[model samples]
Target: MSHAKLFHPKTPEQLKRAVARCARLHSGTEAGEGIELLQTSYENNAISWFLERAKELPLGDYFLWFRKASGITFEDKNEWVPELPVLAGVNMAVVGQLKEIASLSKGHLAVVSNDGRVAVVMDSYSGFLQAEPSPEEIVYELAFWNSLG
Candidate 1:
């Protein structure tokens, strides 16, 4: 897989150049195979590096789930579970305390927590889909399916 470096811009020209570079890099790759790129303001270099390169270098999708409060049930025995929204051609379902869903200026999807404590941002290209479920719910579901084997 190819990788691109994100530059820190000090002027409009630098910013333009960075955008141009990003466009060129994107253009050069085959469809569905472009390099995953990330950018952030330089504050803590370690955090910056981790935030920028974590998703791409690992070459995998990251799953985020919130744990439910006590006495919550994962299964709907009497009611049918509805389908989640399809984003970038993939299906996504929200569980737990997600308050809002919005696309960022750059077209990335952001899911905000109900308490406003955290937001989960997903890349439009990387197939990072979101689902809302308590960790226990996910585990139980997985276990139920795994028992078929």
Candidate 2:
């Protein structure tokens, strides 16, 4: 997989510019590789009536953008489906134990039924911005993920 350097931004304008650049870079790839860009703002939730809530957006916040987006849809917000079909324009799948995804770089994630068709996932987002993998490397990783399954 090819690795690319990430340009982290501290301002909204910089984030938008980075997103636009990612959009352009990803447009040249194959049709089935979906992409998304996400902004990670830490939030805290309270459980029941006994817990207190806390939230914070880091001083130097990180934006994780996906080079290949997914298009998996759900009928019920709490429902889960494994092995969603590959969309026509995007073939990357968000495997492992993820419940919801936020934004996409390109096409939506879909479920390919046993008969072979596409079912798009709605209200979800995929793509993370962190130090683990650069945006370019993420694209390669998605490609590998698509190829494997």
All candidates' TM-scores?
0.19, 0.19
lDDT score, candidate 1, position 117: 23
Clashes of each: 1, 34
Per-residue alpha-carbon lDDT of model 2 for 2-80, expressed as tens digits? 1212323221233233323334434453334432222221211101100110011111122223223322467743322
- Lowest lDDT block of 10, candidate 2: 45-54
lDDT of 1 at 76: 53
In Å, residue 143's CA in model 2 sits off its true spot by 10
lDDT of each: 0.24, 0.24
Q: Give the TM-score of candidate 2.
A: 0.19
Where model 1 places Cα greater than 4 Å from the true spot, the runs are: 1-11, 29-50, 54-104, 108-149
List candidate 2 stretches off by more than 4 Å.
1-11, 29-60, 63-149
The C-alpha local distance difference test score for the whole of candidate 1 amounts to 0.24
**What is the TM-score (0 to 1) of candidate 1?**
0.19
Q: What is the C-alpha RMSD of each candidate to the true structure, in Å?
A: 20.7, 19.9
After TM-score superposition, the amount by which residue 57's alpha carbon in candidate 2 deviates from its true location, in angstroms, is 16
